[model samples]
Target: MPDPTFAGRTVVVTGAGTGIGRATALAFAGQGATTVVVCGRRKERLEEVAAEHPAIVPVVADVATATGARALADEVRARGEGLDVLVHNAGVFRFSPLAALAPDTVREVLDTNLLGPLLVTGELLPALLARRGNIVLVSSRAGHNPGPGSSVYAASKAGVHSLTRSWAAELAVHGVRVNAVAPGYVRTEAYRANGMTDRQVEGLFDAVAGSVPLGRVADTDDITPWITRLADPAASLVTGQVITVDGGMDTGAGQTDQDA
Candidate 1:
């Protein structure tokens, strides 16, 4: 039977053009979220996903900027419905050595990965509080399990993890639940876009799969269900937790230290 946990609910997923964000948006729609706003910087990609899923409403916005984040929240407000779920999934990861890190790049990464979601959450807090909604921040295992050359990226996600706990505690009185999902390496276009050659990508995937206790790297789909579950009202009592969906990579036996 199709799950109706999200029936009549409105869900917003940032960076839903591709990867886990897209997968999470689709999953919510499939489970009967009446309105699924899929926001991303890539207009074409967002449009394509929206075309494939009638329930998806595409918004081409850069959540990396304060203006863009406010605009997105305004668009959601204009829908005239209280939000039921907000997935802060938009983020960026750059693996530059500390010496090579430019100030602009670091600022951009921090703003996009951390500050943007905080802004959007603030903007939508009213709607979410009215509905006692759920917020799912897509964090990274890198926050706690940082590897070589992941200082800034790890810091950004660590901040997200901290925010998740703080928001969960603060919003609990308002009945708004906050949580995070930290996934290990997942196969996505990000690898290619980040300048990894196809052969290198494959090699990295192989290495990751070998290292993971599950003996495989995850795809976007593999990570979506957990996110959806957290957003579901059925998990109303669950909050202030960071659920690691890394296929046992966090265990001492396996350590897949790649961005999800």
Candidate 2:
């Protein structure tokens, strides 16, 4: 049986259809959270997850827009008295060289990755404040260490990290804690769907692993538990921290050797 640490709490996880988001929703549900609001753009996938766990409340909404965020907040307010945990996990990654990057593409990436979380957090702030809740923003190792083709994605995540610190300070007075988790490359279906061949994906993983001291990529399951722990009331004192769950990929020593 799963632990009952979150037996009576209500948690919200955006992008709960797949990858890290799906794993996170399951983790919270397994912990016996009374209401796990799972938001995603895909109705079928969200319903599939919700079906697996009745405690999961699937909400199909594009959280990248202001209207969508307000709708989600309204729905949660209507169902649960208030929200105790908000996981802003919806994000998109795109690859483009600096010279070839289009203005529209950058805007789209920023809107989805950075502004989406801001809007969602803003809409839910009142409820979260009332409950002294916690917010976990899923950033990426790319934020701290940028590569050649992911300029926009890196910028967006860096914004998330900054927001995490800023909000943690801003909300501390209300007893709300905010933090970010930066994950390295994790195996997800999205990569394959995006036209990455198996060999290419494996090669990318191998390259990333070689750069990390731990020499491996993280699994979605591996990161979910830490997120759950951070959201717990026991971690009340931990805020404004960017916890890099990236297998030491962001450490300068390994990259320094590579560059040398």
Candidate 3:
């Protein structure tokens, strides 16, 4: 299944140090992308990803800040290749009730999850237009299904969904498609960093699996293909769509675990 559609194309994947971002970088490389820039704050993690694939060129940048996003775009421009695909996958997840949430924390979450993508995409618009590239934004299920202790995170992702639509409409004439993939409860380090013990994490997954129509949670690999597909040239007519890949968590459209 080696697709040469992206053989000589340049792709940039933000937040590609680990989790879904890392998976996506590898997926694009595997599909024949020549230059895959992995941008993130952690140089060490990016280095590890580079070790896994030679096509992965690690660029340490914090997408949450305007300066960092611009710097990353400049780095891509320095490479002298027009951007073929830009995947906004860098994100932060923090859970706190609205009462206990600090103003600074709220700003940080929104800046990282919402504004960062917008800034980076805006900076790279010229390059994308030159190549008629598309954009793939990594959103979350919380954006649509906001529950307890997820106010800030949910709000940020909801903004992302709106941006997806706005950018899609604006970029259509330029031949750039914009779309998002909203995932629910994928197994990633973010959960551990959010103060959940391994046991607690497992229990949470089991509970969610029991509640969701699907019997299990998702892995990073489970999500990479769909995101890559949207960026693929084959999906030329697809735009302004938020594809939900939550193992039927958002919609109870699958058979429940009890049914199994």
Candidate 4:
């Protein structure tokens, strides 16, 4: 049987060139979305994703910039297809202490992870309202859990959680639900852009895997199902929530006394 939850809907996924974003676009397409607009800064990567599914349409744009964000909205509106599901997944992460990060780097993180969502949502609000659609913000466990050398990234995600609740409250009357999906340490190419060497990234993943009760890091697929479910009509009553898919790492399921 076909899962036609979005058979005729239009879904937009930012940072869809790779990792969670790529997986998410594929999920919506698999669910039968008419058009899954996959946005990212890399044309080649976005094209690759589009090649995997006919429903996926690649649009290279930097959601972090207001101009880029508006351009994307224009493209979507030009198609005359109302937006049904908007997923804010374009984020940048640099694992460094506040002092070590350049002023511009901090701004980059905040712009992409925080302001980008706001800009895109504001641009697409009318379409979302028209369809009574939902928004899914891709946040991180760092929003609640503050590990060392990640203050900027964590703060950006914490802001995402705040936006989830704020937008949910503001859009409820209009029938547009807002929520977030906070993923744990997932093994993705995202780390490759995080300024970590191959060996260091592998070592970090190894250490974090031990803390998870499930005894492993997450893959992109591990986080995709919740995203699709949240946007589906089956979860109509679910809003203003942050669903943490972290393999029980944040739940302390396997933490001993000293670890706690």
Candidate 5:
């Protein structure tokens, strides 16, 4: 049976173009969220996901600029007076070693990955506050332990992690809960999006799959449930927590296959 935990709530998911954002939007709809606004950089991608469910609403809004953030906030305001949940999943993770990083690329990464959440959340704070809502940030396990050639991306996500903790403490007084989901080694377009060729992507996947305790890369399915549950009333007392969904990745290595 489908969960009805979100029967009357409205959810806004940014970066709904492809993987996790797309999956999370659909999951909430399945769980009976009354409205699921799927905002992304691409009109067609968002529409494609929206077509799958009546509750999913598509809106093209870039999270890389204040103008984009304001537009999304306005869109939400037009639909209702309050927003029950806000998912900041919009981010850019183009990889570049420091020497290869261009000024513009750095700006784009910082703007989208770090500033976007702050701008979007600030614009929608009143609406969220009105409902005593929740905010779920999609950070990266790399934020805590950055991988090679991903310094900027890792730093940006680290900023997000810091925001998750700080905002939780700050928003607690107003009854708005803030939490983060830090996903590790998920097999998604992100590798290709990071400018890796298919061969490189496959190679990375093979390597990551080998290192993870579960011995496989994660699908979007592995990550969305924690997101939905965090926003649900069942986790009402949970806030300021960063749930790492990484197939036992964050746990340091020691156990062999036989130990499992």
Candidate 6:
């Protein structure tokens, strides 16, 4: 049976063009959310996802700017008085060693992964508070484990994790829940498109799987249901928590030792 926990909720999922964002938007629609606003820079992809799910609304905007965030807020306000869930899933990633990383790339990553959410969340805070809503930040295990060539991405997500905690505390009295989902090596098209050679990708996955107790990379579908659950009112008391859905990669034996 489909969960009806979100029957009357309206969810906003940024980065809904593809990957985890697409999966999460679909999941919320399947759970009967009244409205699912899918935001992304690509209007075509966002509209495609919306077409697949009639319940979803496509909002094509570069959420990396304050003006874009305000426009999204205005759009949502036009539909209703407030929103019940805000999923800050819009993000970008690039692989570059510290020496090879361009300043623009670092700034872009930080803007999209960190400041973009801050802008959107700030604009939507009043509405969320009015509805006693929930906020879910899509973070990464990179935040917890800073590896070589991921300094900027890791730092950006680490900032997100910190924001999750701070927002949880700040929004608590107002009854708005703030939490984060830290995903480990999930099999997304974006990951596949990374510059790694096939052998390198396979080796990375193999090493990750072997280290994780579950011994597998996560599928996009595998992570969406949890996101839906957290957005539900049933998770009313859950706040300020960064739940890692990393196939035990963040926890199992040798995980800490290997990284150290």
Structural similarity to truth (TM-score) of each candidate: 0.96, 0.94, 0.95, 0.95, 0.95, 0.92
For candidate 1, the TM-score is 0.96
- Which scores greater on lDDT, model 2 or model 5? 5
- Model 6 agreement with the true structure over 6-29: per-residue lDDT tens digits: 888888999998999999999999
lDDT (CA) for every model shown?
A: 0.88, 0.85, 0.88, 0.89, 0.87, 0.85
lDDT of 6 at 187: 73
Please give, for residues 1-260, the per-residue lDDT of candidate 3 as tens digits: 68786899999999999899999999999989999999999899999999988889998899988899988999889998999999999998887787899998898889999989988988999999999999999999788777778788988999999999999999999999999999987888887877989998887778777666767888999999999999988899999999998878667564332110
**Highest TM-score among the candidates is held by which one?**
1
Query: Candidate 1 clashing pairs?
Result: none
Candidate 3: segments with Cα more than 4 A from true spot: 253-260
What value of lDDT does candidate 2 attain over all alpha carbons?
0.85
Report the C-alpha displacement of residue 243, candidate 5, in angstroms.
1.0
Candidate 1 residue 133 Cα shift, in angstroms, is 0.6
RMSD of 5: 3.4
Candidate 4 lDDT, 64-179, residue by residue in tens: 88888887898789988889999999998887775688898889999999999999998999989989999999999889876778888899999999999999999999999998
lDDT tens digits, residue span 94-160, model 2: 7667899999889888998999998999899888988898999999878887777788988999899
Candidate 2's displacement at residue 96, Å, is 1.3
Superposed model 5: Cα runs more than 4 Å off: 254-260
- Give me candidate 3's TM-score against the actual structure: 0.95
